[model samples]
Target chain A: MTDTSATSAAAQAPSGVVDLLGLLAYAELVSFFRLSDAAGLAPDLAAKGELAGVAATEYRHYRMLHERLAAMGADPEAAMAPFVEPLDAWHGRTEPRTWLESLVKTYVGDGIAGDFYRTVAEHADAETAEAVRGAVSETERAEAVAVRVRTAVQEDPKLAGPLSLWARRLVGEALSQAQLVAAARPELAALVARGATGGDSGEGGSGGKGDLAAVSRLFAGLTEAHSARLEAMGLSG
Target chain B: MTDTSATSAAAQAPSGVVDLLGLLAYAELVSFFRLSDAAGLAPDLAAKGELAGVAATEYRHYRMLHERLAAMGADPEAAMAPFVEPLDAWHGRTEPRTWLESLVKTYVGDGIAGDFYRTVAEHADAETAEAVRGAVSETERAEAVAVRVRTAVQEDPKLAGPLSLWARRLVGEALSQAQLVAAARPELAALVARGATGGDSGEGGSGGKGDLAAVSRLFAGLTEAHSARLEAMGLSG
Candidate 1:
């Protein structure tokens, strides 16, 4: 009976994995569109080009996820279909209207998301962990843009208040939607919980931290990193 | 003295080729952004995915042009810089507001431009001609989108009038900006002239027709093609 249950669980794991990958894939797709559109909001050509380069990197990430999903025997389009509306609605509601707003969103939103992925990656299976790690690595470019924005804001302190407020709103919106996603997918939540317990040998739970504790650590690290970045740019920590 | 002059001109030709390649490179970059943005206007997830796939193919073209430009000892960015303002201006002035308008712009604008490149390729030297041919050949995806749009319009005759008007405007705007580019770069104009005149016999330019006559033939063929496409879609020719 235990063996049969284990076999059934193993069979079910792929569907959960497919759903997770599909969600991430669509997120990257939508991110590409948003970043590309945001490129037009840049104040100058070099900034535009840099943001476009970031956008291009997202396309590469999209392609990798797409190939992996196909290899896993799921049509990427079909896998991505379920989350499109909610994701689109979130982005539509949070569209940034200025260059600074866009940068802040990239910085705050992507930074925390990267950290969450890192936590999840610790408990995922080998292939799943690898995919998440690969995607998270691309966040560095967006981080660099954040650094640039911090430096620019330091040079003009009057811009600081507005950008900081924008960053706060971005995080709030992201957290809101993330909770929605988590609520909607119980299997994913359970997978995340297992990873958090440090009991799963897979990437998600391999970090030796409880779920809430792991999340707390992630937020702490992100906050410290952002503070250091801001200080390095001669801004308030 | 003759040898010195010939060597200088030969060296200069590569720079000209780089300019041509760079123009195509930036075109691919912008086209990727535009097509991806336009995909958001798509009514269905499948249509959106299809448009995104088309956008991704443009990056493949960009990589090819970037590699060729690097081989020719030219900085692709610098070569592309001169054309950016004109191209940006053209797109900014003719932003598509509707799904049908976006499709019409893609079909008419890209189709006509591809035709022009075909003519230019015939007049280019061996390597350059091959590059142009390779770049133009990547239009298969865009052509597929055009066919889909035409069928969609045929199914709904109400789409015919607005889309036809949009197509005309797209062509008109494209021609106006192309003339601006032609007037601004006399060397590029000279290259077009020389190529059209069949001056590089090393590439075997003609069986019977002169360069100008060949160019005229190309234009006629392109016009007829677009007319047939439009007519098939139940739009005004």
Candidate 2:
């Protein structure tokens, strides 16, 4: 009794939301690979073990995101395919060359991504929002890495300048990628717009095409936190 | 009052065991790294996850060995120093270049090492023997890798020749290294000989020094297992 065309259309539903999920899933996968690889650079067994522990946590996150994508009627691999090239390229371009660089990468990159997810989760539906909440909460491990870096930098003033510069580049490239994703996916942009401008408030705002305010708030919070961390490490923000 | 010479000698009493324990501890650490790195070559997430699980198990072994070494009145770092260069050289020389090569390395190298440990464990005192027993039993995960490789090789006849050659080379190199260790430390070699020969049967056999019988038995069992695995994979022994 159902129209064949309608069934096909349903099956081929626009997967903009799925694309966002895919992005997050691939991010976790690449993070796992990078952290696991970087663990080799640790100077001692204890530090190596700690880094390996962090790598294991990243794999756990990948599994969770992968399952969520599968539950939403998308092939996790196919959904993940489009984003892999860009994500890989980004990591390739910014591969950390030293122990401090590795820690800074985790602190700045993961910190901003976690903040962005927290804001996005607030605007998402319950299930997806809860997933984002879980992901952001897991950033505690990354915070531990940041604390280690902070302690190390404080003990040696010479480390501060290079690490601060590394942190800046990490944040800059991450923001550039965020802009690319926003421009590439209209549905994702629409989702952000809806989340940012909830209710029909046609007040001073132009047609609520996107939520620049929400975006700015997320970036500002992340930048402030990072700057505070740099200052604590005796580095200029 | 204690003589200064006697006190200094007592302070250095466990130095010899430190080298042996350190080698074992770092072996486990490097195994964890190599296995996890090689896990990337798996064709699917499920397979990759399984490999990661095994690699994590290696970390547990590394922790145990490390703790034991620390408890034995030795600085684990100092203990592990001497073997670092040699083991690192071995790994560098035998780095697997492809996925199949990695699997073969895991199968052949781990299989022989497990057999060697089983033989060595038989000679160790109660506590050391128990620890070795625990480590040997952890080989089940590595065995799974072998079984998977065997099945894959069976499915593709063309894979048989190269893999067989690879397995032979792996075992050959492993045995070469074992001989190197045997020749490097005569006292440790004597300890292994006593363990292998069991109670003062000290018939001391022909050498009146090291027992070749025990070494032969260990090598024979390893060879049998290795041949059976190669046969199972449809490759010549």
Chain B TM-score, one value per candidate, order as shown: 0.75, 0.76
lDDT of 2 by residue, B1-237 (tens): 233443443255322344555666777677767775675577775566556666666666667667655554456666676666666666777878778788777766666546545544654445555776787888645767767777888788788888888778776666566556655654434444444334433234423344455445435555677887677555676
Residues A1-237, candidate 2: write the lDDT tens digits. Answer: 234443443244332556666777777776766676676578776677667666666666677767666655567777677776677677877888888888777776676556546544764446667877777888755667767787888799799888888778876776566666655655554444434344322223322444454345334555676786566445666
- DockQ of all candidate complexes: 0.31, 0.20
Off by over 4 Å in 2: A1-21, A36-40, A67-74, A116-138, A185-208, A211-225, A232-234, B1-24, B36-50, B71-74, B116-138, B186-208, B211-222
On the 0 to 100 scale, the lDDT of residue B221 in model 1 is 52
Candidate 1 lDDT over B123-235, as tens digits, reads: 44576568768657777446676677778787887888888887767656765666666556544544444444445431333322243444443334545667765664457
Evaluated on chain B only, what is the TM-score of candidate 1?
0.75
lDDT of 2: 0.63
Q: What would the per-residue lDDT of candidate 1 be over residues A1-237, giving only the tens digit for each residue?
A: 123333433344432566666777787788777777776787864465566666666677677777766655567788788778767877887888998778776766566556546644764457757877876887755657767777788689898777766655655565566556555654554454444344442335322344344344333455565665445433454
Cα displacement (angstroms), candidate 2, residue A39, comes to 4.5
Q: What is the TM-score of chain A in candidate 2?
A: 0.76
Cα error, residue A229 of model 1, in Å, equals: 7.2
Clashing pairs in 1: A122-A203, A122-A204, A123-A202, A123-A203, A123-A204, A123-A205, A124-A203, A124-A204
